[model samples]
Target: MTDQLSQLKQLTTVVADTGDFASIAQYQPEDATTNPSLILKTIEQSQYQHLATEALQFAASTLANGTQAQRIALAADKLAVLIGHQLMQQVPGYVSTEVDARLSFNSMATIEKAHQLLDLYQQQGADTSRVLIKVAATWEGIQAARVLEQQGIRCNLTLIFSFAQARASAEASAFLISPFVGRILDWYKKQQPDADFSGAQDPGVQFVRKVYQYFKQHRYPTIVMGASFRNTEEIRQLAGCDRLTISPNLLAELADSHQPVIRQLHADVPFIEVPGALTEAEFRWQMLEDPMATDKLLEGIRQFAADQQKLEELLKAV
Candidate 1:
Protein backbone atom coordinates (compact mmCIF):
# COMPACT_ATOMS: atom_id res chain seq x y z
CA MET A 1 0.00 0.00 0.00
CA THR A 2 1.16 3.53 -0.74
CA ASP A 3 1.97 5.87 2.11
CA GLN A 4 -0.63 8.50 2.99
CA LEU A 5 1.35 11.36 1.48
CA SER A 6 1.74 9.54 -1.81
CA GLN A 7 -1.84 8.37 -1.70
CA LEU A 8 -3.05 11.91 -1.03
CA LYS A 9 -0.97 13.23 -3.91
CA GLN A 10 -2.76 10.84 -6.20
CA LEU A 11 -5.86 13.02 -5.70
CA THR A 12 -4.68 16.54 -4.93
CA THR A 13 -1.77 18.93 -5.35
CA VAL A 14 -0.21 19.92 -2.01
CA VAL A 15 1.30 23.41 -1.66
CA ALA A 16 3.29 24.73 1.27
CA ASP A 17 2.04 27.84 3.05
CA THR A 18 5.02 29.61 4.60
CA GLY A 19 7.98 31.96 4.14
CA ASP A 20 10.44 29.68 5.91
CA PHE A 21 13.00 28.14 3.51
CA ALA A 22 13.77 25.19 5.79
CA SER A 23 10.17 23.96 5.74
CA ILE A 24 10.02 24.04 1.95
CA ALA A 25 13.08 21.78 1.70
CA GLN A 26 11.62 19.22 4.11
CA TYR A 27 8.14 18.59 2.66
CA GLN A 28 9.00 19.51 -0.92
CA PRO A 29 5.55 20.81 -1.84
CA GLU A 30 4.92 21.73 -5.44
CA ASP A 31 4.18 25.42 -4.64
CA ALA A 32 4.27 27.97 -1.79
CA THR A 33 2.20 30.97 -0.58
CA THR A 34 3.19 34.05 1.46
CA ASN A 35 1.34 37.04 2.84
CA PRO A 36 1.99 39.99 5.15
CA SER A 37 1.19 37.88 8.21
CA LEU A 38 3.42 34.97 7.18
CA ILE A 39 6.21 37.32 6.16
CA LEU A 40 5.88 39.21 9.44
CA LYS A 41 5.94 35.97 11.43
CA THR A 42 8.99 34.79 9.50
CA ILE A 43 10.82 38.07 10.15
CA GLU A 44 10.39 37.57 13.91
CA GLN A 45 11.99 34.14 13.83
CA SER A 46 15.78 33.90 14.32
CA GLN A 47 16.10 31.52 11.41
CA TYR A 48 14.47 33.92 8.92
CA GLN A 49 16.47 37.05 9.81
CA HIS A 50 18.63 36.64 6.74
CA LEU A 51 15.54 36.93 4.57
CA ALA A 52 14.66 40.24 6.23
CA THR A 53 18.21 41.54 5.91
CA GLU A 54 18.33 40.66 2.24
CA ALA A 55 15.02 42.42 1.71
CA LEU A 56 16.25 45.50 3.52
CA GLN A 57 19.45 45.60 1.52
CA PHE A 58 17.56 45.31 -1.75
CA ALA A 59 15.18 48.05 -0.67
CA ALA A 60 18.02 50.33 0.29
CA SER A 61 19.78 49.83 -3.02
CA THR A 62 16.73 50.39 -5.25
CA LEU A 63 15.10 53.19 -3.25
CA ALA A 64 18.29 55.26 -3.06
CA ASN A 65 16.55 57.89 -5.21
CA GLY A 66 12.99 57.61 -3.87
CA THR A 67 10.92 58.85 -0.92
CA GLN A 68 10.61 56.97 2.39
CA ALA A 69 7.16 55.57 1.61
CA GLN A 70 8.25 54.71 -1.88
CA ARG A 71 11.28 52.93 -0.50
CA ILE A 72 9.12 51.00 1.94
CA ALA A 73 6.70 49.97 -0.78
CA LEU A 74 9.61 48.98 -2.97
CA ALA A 75 11.12 47.01 -0.12
CA ALA A 76 7.91 45.10 0.50
CA ASP A 77 7.68 44.24 -3.19
CA LYS A 78 11.33 43.26 -3.40
CA LEU A 79 11.13 41.11 -0.30
CA ALA A 80 8.01 39.31 -1.48
CA VAL A 81 9.36 38.79 -4.98
CA LEU A 82 12.72 37.64 -3.61
CA ILE A 83 10.99 35.11 -1.40
CA GLY A 84 9.00 33.89 -4.36
CA HIS A 85 12.11 33.49 -6.47
CA GLN A 86 13.89 31.57 -3.72
CA LEU A 87 10.95 29.25 -3.12
CA MET A 88 10.61 28.55 -6.84
CA GLN A 89 14.13 27.16 -6.74
CA GLN A 90 12.68 24.36 -4.61
CA VAL A 91 9.00 24.04 -5.69
CA PRO A 92 8.26 23.43 -9.37
CA GLY A 93 4.79 24.95 -9.09
CA TYR A 94 3.96 28.66 -8.90
CA VAL A 95 4.55 30.92 -5.87
CA SER A 96 1.72 33.22 -4.75
CA THR A 97 2.72 36.78 -3.79
CA GLU A 98 -0.08 38.83 -2.31
CA VAL A 99 -0.91 42.46 -3.10
CA ASP A 100 -1.08 45.02 -0.31
CA ALA A 101 -4.18 44.09 1.67
CA ARG A 102 -4.86 47.81 2.12
CA LEU A 103 -5.91 47.83 -1.50
CA SER A 104 -8.42 45.02 -1.16
CA PHE A 105 -11.46 47.30 -1.33
CA ASN A 106 -10.20 49.43 -4.21
CA SER A 107 -10.46 47.71 -7.58
CA MET A 108 -8.28 50.14 -9.53
CA ALA A 109 -5.69 50.46 -6.77
CA THR A 110 -5.45 46.71 -6.46
CA ILE A 111 -4.94 46.32 -10.20
CA GLU A 112 -2.14 48.88 -10.30
CA LYS A 113 -0.45 47.36 -7.22
CA ALA A 114 -0.60 43.91 -8.80
CA HIS A 115 1.04 45.21 -11.96
CA GLN A 116 3.75 46.83 -9.84
CA LEU A 117 4.45 43.57 -8.00
CA LEU A 118 4.54 41.63 -11.27
CA ASP A 119 6.86 44.23 -12.80
CA LEU A 120 9.33 43.86 -9.93
CA TYR A 121 9.35 40.07 -10.34
CA GLN A 122 9.94 40.40 -14.07
CA GLN A 123 12.87 42.75 -13.45
CA GLN A 124 14.53 39.96 -11.45
CA GLY A 125 14.41 37.71 -14.55
CA ALA A 126 11.65 35.66 -12.97
CA ASP A 127 8.99 34.25 -15.27
CA THR A 128 5.69 35.97 -14.54
CA SER A 129 4.01 32.80 -15.80
CA ARG A 130 5.16 30.96 -12.68
CA VAL A 131 3.77 33.66 -10.41
CA LEU A 132 0.27 33.78 -8.96
CA ILE A 133 -0.44 37.30 -7.70
CA LYS A 134 -2.66 36.92 -4.63
CA VAL A 135 -5.54 39.31 -3.84
CA ALA A 136 -8.29 39.39 -1.29
CA ALA A 137 -11.60 37.88 -2.49
CA THR A 138 -13.64 41.00 -2.02
CA TRP A 139 -15.94 41.99 -4.87
CA GLU A 140 -13.49 44.69 -5.77
CA GLY A 141 -10.67 42.20 -5.52
CA ILE A 142 -12.43 39.82 -7.90
CA GLN A 143 -12.97 42.63 -10.36
CA ALA A 144 -9.27 43.44 -10.19
CA ALA A 145 -8.43 39.77 -10.76
CA ARG A 146 -10.65 39.70 -13.80
CA VAL A 147 -8.69 42.60 -15.23
CA LEU A 148 -5.36 40.99 -14.33
CA GLU A 149 -6.40 37.66 -15.87
CA GLN A 150 -7.21 39.45 -19.13
CA GLN A 151 -3.73 40.95 -19.03
CA GLY A 152 -2.16 37.43 -18.73
CA ILE A 153 -1.52 37.84 -15.01
CA ARG A 154 -2.86 34.86 -13.08
CA CYS A 155 -4.34 35.58 -9.65
CA ASN A 156 -4.87 33.71 -6.39
CA LEU A 157 -8.00 35.05 -4.69
CA THR A 158 -7.22 34.91 -0.96
CA LEU A 159 -9.08 35.61 2.32
CA ILE A 160 -12.07 33.78 0.90
CA PHE A 161 -14.56 32.26 3.38
CA SER A 162 -18.01 32.41 1.83
CA PHE A 163 -19.56 30.47 -1.05
CA ALA A 164 -20.66 33.79 -2.51
CA GLN A 165 -17.05 34.85 -2.78
CA ALA A 166 -16.14 31.55 -4.44
CA ARG A 167 -18.96 31.85 -6.96
CA ALA A 168 -17.99 35.40 -7.88
CA SER A 169 -14.38 34.32 -8.33
CA ALA A 170 -15.33 31.41 -10.59
CA GLU A 171 -17.64 33.59 -12.60
CA ALA A 172 -14.78 36.00 -13.08
CA SER A 173 -12.62 33.11 -14.30
CA ALA A 174 -9.94 33.61 -11.69
CA PHE A 175 -6.75 31.56 -11.89
CA LEU A 176 -7.24 30.14 -8.39
CA ILE A 177 -9.26 30.50 -5.19
CA SER A 178 -8.02 29.90 -1.62
CA PRO A 179 -10.79 29.05 0.82
CA PHE A 180 -9.48 29.22 4.38
CA VAL A 181 -10.26 25.92 6.16
CA GLY A 182 -8.89 26.69 9.61
CA ARG A 183 -10.65 30.04 9.84
CA ILE A 184 -13.96 28.43 9.02
CA LEU A 185 -13.37 25.86 11.75
CA ASP A 186 -12.54 28.66 14.16
CA TRP A 187 -15.91 30.27 13.49
CA TYR A 188 -17.82 26.99 13.78
CA LYS A 189 -16.14 25.94 17.01
CA LYS A 190 -17.25 29.17 18.58
CA GLN A 191 -20.89 28.91 17.50
CA GLN A 192 -21.61 25.19 17.29
CA PRO A 193 -20.53 23.41 20.41
CA ASP A 194 -22.03 20.10 19.27
CA ALA A 195 -20.38 20.00 15.85
CA ASP A 196 -19.46 16.59 14.54
CA PHE A 197 -16.04 15.77 13.14
CA SER A 198 -16.57 12.42 11.47
CA GLY A 199 -15.97 11.34 7.90
CA ALA A 200 -15.46 14.68 6.13
CA GLN A 201 -18.15 16.54 8.07
CA ASP A 202 -16.37 19.41 9.81
CA PRO A 203 -17.71 22.82 8.78
CA GLY A 204 -14.38 24.04 7.45
CA VAL A 205 -13.73 20.82 5.57
CA GLN A 206 -17.29 20.83 4.31
CA PHE A 207 -16.94 24.41 3.00
CA VAL A 208 -13.96 23.60 0.77
CA ARG A 209 -15.50 20.30 -0.32
CA LYS A 210 -18.67 22.09 -1.33
CA VAL A 211 -16.76 24.65 -3.40
CA TYR A 212 -14.66 21.89 -4.96
CA GLN A 213 -17.72 19.82 -5.86
CA TYR A 214 -19.47 22.85 -7.29
CA PHE A 215 -16.56 23.80 -9.49
CA LYS A 216 -15.99 20.22 -10.62
CA GLN A 217 -19.66 19.60 -11.20
CA HIS A 218 -20.20 22.75 -13.22
CA ARG A 219 -16.90 22.51 -15.02
CA TYR A 220 -15.77 25.84 -13.63
CA PRO A 221 -12.11 26.06 -14.61
CA THR A 222 -11.10 27.95 -11.49
CA ILE A 223 -8.77 26.00 -9.17
CA VAL A 224 -9.79 25.57 -5.53
CA MET A 225 -6.94 25.56 -3.01
CA GLY A 226 -7.83 24.62 0.58
CA ALA A 227 -5.66 26.76 2.82
CA SER A 228 -5.20 27.98 6.45
CA PHE A 229 -5.44 24.61 8.14
CA ARG A 230 -5.73 24.07 11.92
CA ASN A 231 -5.00 20.38 12.16
CA THR A 232 -3.83 17.36 10.22
CA GLU A 233 -7.33 15.94 10.39
CA GLU A 234 -8.68 18.86 8.36
CA ILE A 235 -5.80 18.41 5.97
CA ARG A 236 -6.47 14.67 5.78
CA GLN A 237 -10.16 15.28 5.18
CA LEU A 238 -9.30 17.49 2.22
CA ALA A 239 -6.74 15.11 0.77
CA GLY A 240 -8.40 14.87 -2.65
CA CYS A 241 -8.97 18.59 -3.11
CA ASP A 242 -7.68 20.45 -6.14
CA ARG A 243 -4.89 21.85 -3.94
CA LEU A 244 -4.16 22.26 -0.25
CA THR A 245 -1.69 25.00 0.83
CA ILE A 246 -0.54 23.79 4.23
CA SER A 247 1.62 25.42 6.89
CA PRO A 248 5.09 23.97 7.49
CA ASN A 249 4.12 22.73 10.94
CA LEU A 250 1.31 20.58 9.51
CA LEU A 251 3.48 19.49 6.58
CA ALA A 252 6.09 18.31 9.07
CA GLU A 253 3.39 16.50 11.02
CA LEU A 254 2.10 14.83 7.85
CA ALA A 255 5.62 13.80 6.85
CA ASP A 256 6.49 12.37 10.26
CA SER A 257 3.63 9.89 10.56
CA HIS A 258 2.66 6.92 8.45
CA GLN A 259 -1.11 6.99 8.48
CA PRO A 260 -3.77 5.96 6.01
CA VAL A 261 -4.84 8.98 4.00
CA ILE A 262 -7.91 8.42 1.89
CA ARG A 263 -8.85 10.23 -1.31
CA GLN A 264 -11.65 12.72 -0.68
CA LEU A 265 -11.53 14.77 -3.90
CA HIS A 266 -11.15 13.52 -7.46
CA ALA A 267 -11.98 14.71 -10.94
CA ASP A 268 -13.93 11.56 -11.69
CA VAL A 269 -16.23 11.71 -8.70
CA PRO A 270 -19.82 12.91 -9.12
CA PHE A 271 -20.40 16.38 -7.71
CA ILE A 272 -23.23 17.25 -5.39
CA GLU A 273 -26.13 19.39 -6.59
CA VAL A 274 -25.38 23.10 -6.33
CA PRO A 275 -27.03 26.38 -7.26
CA GLY A 276 -26.03 28.70 -10.09
CA ALA A 277 -24.61 32.22 -10.16
CA LEU A 278 -26.00 34.46 -7.46
CA THR A 279 -27.16 37.97 -8.19
CA GLU A 280 -25.70 40.92 -6.31
CA ALA A 281 -28.81 41.11 -4.16
CA GLU A 282 -28.80 37.37 -3.57
CA PHE A 283 -25.15 37.40 -2.71
CA ARG A 284 -25.69 40.17 -0.22
CA TRP A 285 -28.70 38.37 1.24
CA GLN A 286 -26.88 35.07 1.60
CA MET A 287 -23.93 36.74 3.24
CA LEU A 288 -26.28 38.44 5.63
CA GLU A 289 -27.97 35.13 6.40
CA ASP A 290 -24.73 33.43 7.30
CA PRO A 291 -23.40 35.45 10.20
CA MET A 292 -20.26 33.36 10.51
CA ALA A 293 -19.17 33.93 6.92
CA THR A 294 -20.02 37.61 7.17
CA ASP A 295 -18.07 38.13 10.36
CA LYS A 296 -15.11 36.05 9.28
CA LEU A 297 -14.74 37.71 5.90
CA LEU A 298 -14.76 41.16 7.48
CA GLU A 299 -12.38 40.10 10.22
CA GLY A 300 -9.95 38.47 7.80
CA ILE A 301 -9.80 41.57 5.62
CA ARG A 302 -9.24 43.82 8.65
CA GLN A 303 -6.43 41.62 9.92
CA PHE A 304 -4.70 41.61 6.54
CA ALA A 305 -5.11 45.36 6.24
CA ALA A 306 -3.55 45.87 9.65
CA ASP A 307 -0.64 43.65 8.71
CA GLN A 308 -0.09 45.58 5.50
CA GLN A 309 0.14 48.79 7.49
CA LYS A 310 2.62 47.25 9.89
CA LEU A 311 4.74 46.03 6.96
CA GLU A 312 4.79 49.55 5.59
CA GLU A 313 5.99 50.79 8.98
CA LEU A 314 8.69 48.14 9.07
CA LEU A 315 9.92 49.30 5.69
CA LYS A 316 10.02 52.87 7.00
CA ALA A 317 12.15 51.85 9.98
CA VAL A 318 14.50 49.96 7.70
Candidate 2:
Protein backbone atom coordinates (compact mmCIF):
# COMPACT_ATOMS: atom_id res chain seq x y z
CA MET A 1 0.00 0.00 0.00
CA THR A 2 1.29 3.43 -0.94
CA ASP A 3 1.69 6.04 1.75
CA GLN A 4 -0.81 8.89 1.83
CA LEU A 5 1.90 11.31 0.75
CA SER A 6 2.59 9.39 -2.44
CA GLN A 7 -1.12 9.12 -3.16
CA LEU A 8 -1.57 12.86 -2.64
CA LYS A 9 1.09 13.51 -5.26
CA GLN A 10 -1.10 11.77 -7.82
CA LEU A 11 -3.80 14.44 -7.37
CA THR A 12 -2.01 17.56 -6.17
CA THR A 13 1.45 19.02 -6.34
CA VAL A 14 3.14 18.71 -2.94
CA VAL A 15 5.26 21.66 -1.86
CA ALA A 16 7.48 21.56 1.21
CA ASP A 17 6.74 24.57 3.39
CA THR A 18 10.11 24.77 5.06
CA GLY A 19 13.59 26.17 4.73
CA ASP A 20 15.44 23.14 6.06
CA PHE A 21 17.27 21.36 3.26
CA ALA A 22 17.21 18.06 5.12
CA SER A 23 13.41 18.10 5.30
CA ILE A 24 13.17 18.90 1.61
CA ALA A 25 15.51 16.04 0.76
CA GLN A 26 13.60 13.67 3.02
CA TYR A 27 10.21 14.49 1.58
CA GLN A 28 11.35 14.88 -2.02
CA PRO A 29 8.67 17.50 -2.60
CA GLU A 30 8.50 19.03 -6.03
CA ASP A 31 8.78 22.62 -4.73
CA ALA A 32 9.70 24.41 -1.50
CA THR A 33 8.69 27.67 0.21
CA THR A 34 10.44 29.99 2.65
CA ASN A 35 9.42 32.97 4.74
CA PRO A 36 11.08 35.16 7.33
CA SER A 37 10.27 32.73 10.13
CA LEU A 38 11.35 29.60 8.30
CA ILE A 39 14.60 31.13 7.08
CA LEU A 40 15.44 32.44 10.55
CA LYS A 41 14.78 29.00 12.04
CA THR A 42 16.88 27.22 9.41
CA ILE A 43 19.80 29.64 9.64
CA GLU A 44 20.02 29.29 13.42
CA GLN A 45 21.05 25.69 13.01
CA SER A 46 24.80 24.93 13.04
CA GLN A 47 24.77 23.19 9.69
CA TYR A 48 23.35 26.28 7.93
CA GLN A 49 25.51 28.85 9.73
CA HIS A 50 27.83 29.06 6.76
CA LEU A 51 25.06 30.45 4.55
CA ALA A 52 24.61 33.30 6.99
CA THR A 53 28.36 33.86 7.08
CA GLU A 54 28.47 34.05 3.31
CA ALA A 55 25.52 36.44 3.24
CA LEU A 56 27.13 38.69 5.85
CA GLN A 57 30.36 38.76 3.91
CA PHE A 58 28.52 39.69 0.72
CA ALA A 59 26.77 42.52 2.58
CA ALA A 60 30.07 43.78 4.04
CA SER A 61 31.85 43.82 0.69
CA THR A 62 28.96 45.21 -1.32
CA LEU A 63 27.82 47.84 1.17
CA ALA A 64 31.20 49.00 2.43
CA ASN A 65 29.97 52.50 3.30
CA GLY A 66 26.36 51.59 3.98
CA THR A 67 24.58 52.12 7.29
CA GLN A 68 24.14 49.30 9.76
CA ALA A 69 20.48 49.02 8.76
CA GLN A 70 21.29 48.93 5.04
CA ARG A 71 23.95 46.29 5.57
CA ILE A 72 21.61 44.19 7.65
CA ALA A 73 18.84 44.48 5.08
CA LEU A 74 21.12 43.43 2.23
CA ALA A 75 22.44 40.53 4.24
CA ALA A 76 18.89 39.40 5.00
CA ASP A 77 18.00 39.48 1.34
CA LYS A 78 21.19 37.67 0.44
CA LEU A 79 20.52 35.06 3.10
CA ALA A 80 17.01 34.41 1.78
CA VAL A 81 18.29 34.09 -1.79
CA LEU A 82 21.16 31.85 -0.73
CA ILE A 83 18.73 29.59 1.07
CA GLY A 84 16.43 29.62 -1.95
CA HIS A 85 19.26 28.87 -4.37
CA GLN A 86 20.26 25.91 -2.24
CA LEU A 87 16.64 24.78 -2.21
CA MET A 88 16.61 25.04 -5.99
CA GLN A 89 19.34 22.40 -6.04
CA GLN A 90 17.10 20.05 -4.06
CA VAL A 91 13.76 20.62 -5.82
CA PRO A 92 13.01 20.49 -9.52
CA GLY A 93 10.36 23.21 -9.20
CA TYR A 94 10.12 26.82 -8.05
CA VAL A 95 11.36 27.98 -4.61
CA SER A 96 9.38 30.80 -2.99
CA THR A 97 11.39 33.67 -1.47
CA GLU A 98 9.31 36.28 0.28
CA VAL A 99 9.91 40.01 0.28
CA ASP A 100 10.21 41.92 3.56
CA ALA A 101 6.89 41.73 5.36
CA ARG A 102 7.48 45.32 6.45
CA LEU A 103 6.97 46.26 2.82
CA SER A 104 3.64 44.50 2.69
CA PHE A 105 1.75 47.68 1.82
CA ASN A 106 4.41 49.29 -0.33
CA SER A 107 3.82 48.34 -3.93
CA MET A 108 6.93 49.85 -5.48
CA ALA A 109 9.11 48.77 -2.60
CA THR A 110 7.84 45.23 -2.90
CA ILE A 111 8.62 45.19 -6.61
CA GLU A 112 12.08 46.59 -6.00
CA LYS A 113 12.85 44.00 -3.33
CA ALA A 114 11.66 41.25 -5.64
CA HIS A 115 14.07 42.43 -8.33
CA GLN A 116 16.91 42.44 -5.83
CA LEU A 117 16.11 38.86 -4.84
CA LEU A 118 16.01 37.81 -8.47
CA ASP A 119 19.30 39.56 -9.13
CA LEU A 120 20.92 37.75 -6.24
CA TYR A 121 19.61 34.47 -7.64
CA GLN A 122 21.02 35.29 -11.06
CA GLN A 123 24.38 36.16 -9.50
CA GLN A 124 24.40 32.66 -8.09
CA GLY A 125 23.88 31.27 -11.62
CA ALA A 126 20.40 30.17 -10.69
CA ASP A 127 17.57 29.96 -13.17
CA THR A 128 15.30 32.85 -12.17
CA SER A 129 12.28 31.03 -13.56
CA ARG A 130 12.57 28.62 -10.68
CA VAL A 131 11.97 31.45 -8.23
CA LEU A 132 8.65 32.80 -6.90
CA ILE A 133 8.66 36.17 -5.23
CA LYS A 134 6.21 35.92 -2.34
CA VAL A 135 4.24 39.05 -1.46
CA ALA A 136 1.52 39.61 1.08
CA ALA A 137 -1.89 39.77 -0.58
CA THR A 138 -2.56 43.35 0.41
CA TRP A 139 -4.12 45.58 -2.21
CA GLU A 140 -0.79 47.28 -2.66
CA GLY A 141 0.98 43.97 -2.79
CA ILE A 142 -1.45 42.76 -5.46
CA GLN A 143 -0.66 45.88 -7.45
CA ALA A 144 3.01 45.07 -7.04
CA ALA A 145 2.36 41.55 -8.25
CA ARG A 146 0.56 42.90 -11.26
CA VAL A 147 3.62 44.88 -12.20
CA LEU A 148 6.01 42.03 -11.45
CA GLU A 149 3.93 39.55 -13.46
CA GLN A 150 3.96 41.94 -16.38
CA GLN A 151 7.74 41.91 -16.25
CA GLY A 152 7.66 38.09 -16.36
CA ILE A 153 8.38 37.61 -12.68
CA ARG A 154 6.22 34.92 -11.15
CA CYS A 155 4.78 35.80 -7.74
CA ASN A 156 3.19 33.92 -4.86
CA LEU A 157 0.60 36.18 -3.23
CA THR A 158 0.33 34.96 0.34
CA LEU A 159 -1.39 35.83 3.64
CA ILE A 160 -4.68 35.20 1.94
CA PHE A 161 -7.75 34.90 4.27
CA SER A 162 -10.69 36.23 2.28
CA PHE A 163 -12.28 35.63 -1.10
CA ALA A 164 -11.70 39.26 -2.05
CA GLN A 165 -7.97 38.85 -1.59
CA ALA A 166 -7.89 35.69 -3.66
CA ARG A 167 -9.96 37.20 -6.45
CA ALA A 168 -7.78 40.32 -6.55
CA SER A 169 -4.66 38.18 -6.80
CA ALA A 170 -6.13 36.26 -9.71
CA GLU A 171 -7.12 39.54 -11.34
CA ALA A 172 -3.51 40.58 -11.03
CA SER A 173 -2.54 37.37 -12.83
CA ALA A 174 -0.27 36.19 -10.07
CA PHE A 175 1.51 32.92 -10.62
CA LEU A 176 0.10 31.53 -7.39
CA ILE A 177 -1.81 32.38 -4.22
CA SER A 178 -1.27 30.57 -0.89
CA PRO A 179 -4.52 30.68 1.06
CA PHE A 180 -3.81 29.45 4.57
CA VAL A 181 -6.01 26.56 5.76
CA GLY A 182 -4.93 25.81 9.33
CA ARG A 183 -4.87 29.46 10.26
CA ILE A 184 -8.54 29.83 9.40
CA LEU A 185 -9.38 26.82 11.55
CA ASP A 186 -7.42 28.36 14.38
CA TRP A 187 -9.53 31.53 14.31
CA TYR A 188 -12.85 29.67 14.28
CA LYS A 189 -11.77 27.30 17.02
CA LYS A 190 -10.94 30.32 19.13
CA GLN A 191 -14.37 31.86 18.58
CA GLN A 192 -16.37 28.65 19.02
CA PRO A 193 -14.47 26.64 21.58
CA ASP A 194 -17.07 23.87 21.80
CA ALA A 195 -18.10 23.57 18.15
CA ASP A 196 -17.72 20.19 16.52
CA PHE A 197 -15.34 21.50 13.87
CA SER A 198 -14.14 18.23 12.48
CA GLY A 199 -14.13 16.74 8.98
CA ALA A 200 -15.86 18.65 6.17
CA GLN A 201 -17.32 21.04 8.73
CA ASP A 202 -13.82 22.49 9.25
CA PRO A 203 -13.98 26.19 8.31
CA GLY A 204 -10.47 26.16 6.88
CA VAL A 205 -11.24 23.22 4.65
CA GLN A 206 -14.52 24.77 3.60
CA PHE A 207 -12.88 28.12 2.81
CA VAL A 208 -10.33 26.56 0.46
CA ARG A 209 -13.01 24.45 -1.17
CA LYS A 210 -15.06 27.56 -1.90
CA VAL A 211 -12.08 29.48 -3.29
CA TYR A 212 -11.01 26.53 -5.43
CA GLN A 213 -14.45 26.30 -6.93
CA TYR A 214 -14.61 30.01 -7.68
CA PHE A 215 -11.21 30.02 -9.38
CA LYS A 216 -12.08 27.08 -11.55
CA GLN A 217 -15.49 28.46 -12.42
CA HIS A 218 -13.97 31.72 -13.61
CA ARG A 219 -11.18 29.89 -15.45
CA TYR A 220 -8.66 31.94 -13.55
CA PRO A 221 -5.07 30.90 -14.26
CA THR A 222 -3.68 31.72 -10.82
CA ILE A 223 -2.81 28.57 -8.91
CA VAL A 224 -4.50 28.20 -5.49
CA MET A 225 -1.79 26.62 -3.33
CA GLY A 226 -3.25 25.82 0.08
CA ALA A 227 -0.75 26.59 2.84
CA SER A 228 -0.17 26.68 6.63
CA PHE A 229 -1.90 23.43 7.51
CA ARG A 230 -2.08 22.41 11.19
CA ASN A 231 -2.86 18.70 10.77
CA THR A 232 -3.07 15.86 8.32
CA GLU A 233 -6.89 16.04 8.25
CA GLU A 234 -6.72 19.56 6.81
CA ILE A 235 -4.20 18.30 4.29
CA ARG A 236 -6.39 15.30 3.45
CA GLN A 237 -9.40 17.56 2.96
CA LEU A 238 -7.65 19.68 0.38
CA ALA A 239 -6.14 16.71 -1.45
CA GLY A 240 -6.95 17.79 -4.97
CA CYS A 241 -6.16 21.47 -4.65
CA ASP A 242 -3.92 23.02 -7.27
CA ARG A 243 -1.02 22.62 -4.84
CA LEU A 244 -0.40 22.36 -1.12
CA THR A 245 2.59 23.60 0.83
CA ILE A 246 3.01 21.35 3.86
CA SER A 247 5.32 21.77 6.82
CA PRO A 248 7.86 19.04 7.63
CA ASN A 249 5.76 17.49 10.41
CA LEU A 250 2.62 17.13 8.29
CA LEU A 251 4.67 15.80 5.39
CA ALA A 252 6.16 13.18 7.69
CA GLU A 253 2.72 12.20 8.96
CA LEU A 254 1.47 11.77 5.43
CA ALA A 255 4.60 9.83 4.45
CA ASP A 256 4.11 7.48 7.39
CA SER A 257 0.38 6.88 6.95
CA HIS A 258 -0.85 4.09 4.68
CA GLN A 259 -4.54 5.06 4.64
CA PRO A 260 -6.01 5.47 1.22
CA VAL A 261 -6.08 9.11 0.09
CA ILE A 262 -8.89 10.19 -2.21
CA ARG A 263 -9.34 13.41 -4.13
CA GLN A 264 -11.82 15.67 -2.32
CA LEU A 265 -11.68 18.78 -4.55
CA HIS A 266 -12.24 19.05 -8.26
CA ALA A 267 -12.51 21.73 -10.98
CA ASP A 268 -15.96 20.66 -12.03
CA VAL A 269 -17.87 21.99 -9.05
CA PRO A 270 -21.01 24.03 -9.82
CA PHE A 271 -20.18 27.62 -10.61
CA ILE A 272 -20.77 30.11 -7.83
CA GLU A 273 -21.78 33.70 -8.51
CA VAL A 274 -18.89 35.54 -10.19
CA PRO A 275 -18.89 39.07 -8.96
CA GLY A 276 -17.05 41.33 -11.38
CA ALA A 277 -13.66 42.73 -10.47
CA LEU A 278 -13.43 43.94 -6.89
CA THR A 279 -12.64 47.60 -6.47
CA GLU A 280 -10.16 48.75 -3.84
CA ALA A 281 -12.94 50.02 -1.60
CA GLU A 282 -14.96 46.85 -2.04
CA PHE A 283 -11.91 44.76 -1.19
CA ARG A 284 -11.20 46.71 1.98
CA TRP A 285 -14.88 46.58 2.90
CA GLN A 286 -14.94 42.81 2.51
CA MET A 287 -11.95 42.47 4.77
CA LEU A 288 -13.59 44.76 7.30
CA GLU A 289 -16.77 42.67 7.32
CA ASP A 290 -14.88 39.46 7.93
CA PRO A 291 -13.31 40.09 11.31
CA MET A 292 -11.62 36.72 11.18
CA ALA A 293 -9.80 37.61 7.99
CA THR A 294 -8.92 41.09 9.17
CA ASP A 295 -7.56 39.79 12.44
CA LYS A 296 -5.58 36.99 10.82
CA LEU A 297 -4.13 39.15 8.06
CA LEU A 298 -2.91 41.74 10.51
CA GLU A 299 -1.61 39.08 12.86
CA GLY A 300 0.18 37.23 10.07
CA ILE A 301 1.86 40.42 8.83
CA ARG A 302 2.98 41.45 12.30
CA GLN A 303 4.37 37.97 12.98
CA PHE A 304 6.26 37.83 9.71
CA ALA A 305 7.59 41.35 10.22
CA ALA A 306 8.73 40.49 13.71
CA ASP A 307 10.50 37.41 12.44
CA GLN A 308 12.08 39.53 9.70
CA GLN A 309 13.39 41.92 12.30
CA LYS A 310 14.78 39.03 14.32
CA LEU A 311 16.45 37.63 11.22
CA GLU A 312 18.07 40.99 10.54
CA GLU A 313 19.32 41.29 14.10
CA LEU A 314 20.91 37.87 13.77
CA LEU A 315 22.56 38.97 10.56
CA LYS A 316 23.83 42.12 12.24
CA ALA A 317 25.49 40.09 14.96
CA VAL A 318 27.15 37.87 12.39
Q: Who wins the lDDT comparison?
A: 2
Residue-level lDDT tens digits of model 2 in 1-318: 899999999999999999999999999999999999999999999999999999999998999999989988999999999999999999999999999999999999999999999999999999999999999999999999999999999999999999999999998899999999989999999999999889888998899998898899988889999999989999898999999999999999999999999899998866556667889999999999999999999999999999999998888777
Off by over 4 Å in 2: 269-275
Give the per-residue lDDT of model 1 (tens digit) for 1-318.
Answer: 655566667678989899888888987888899998888777667776676677777777977888777777778778788888888888999999999887888999999998888888888889889999999988888989999999999999998889989999998889999999989888888887787755477788999988888899888889999999888899888888889998988877777777888777677656556556667687778778978888988898889778877777766664
How much lDDT does each candidate structure score?
Answer: 0.84, 0.94
Task: Give lDDT: candidate 1, residue 291.
Answer: 88
Model 1 spans with C-alpha error above 4 angstroms: 1-3, 269-277
Look at candidate 2 and give me any clashing residue pairs. none
TM-score of each: 0.92, 0.98
For model 1, what is the alpha-carbon lDDT of residue 260? 85
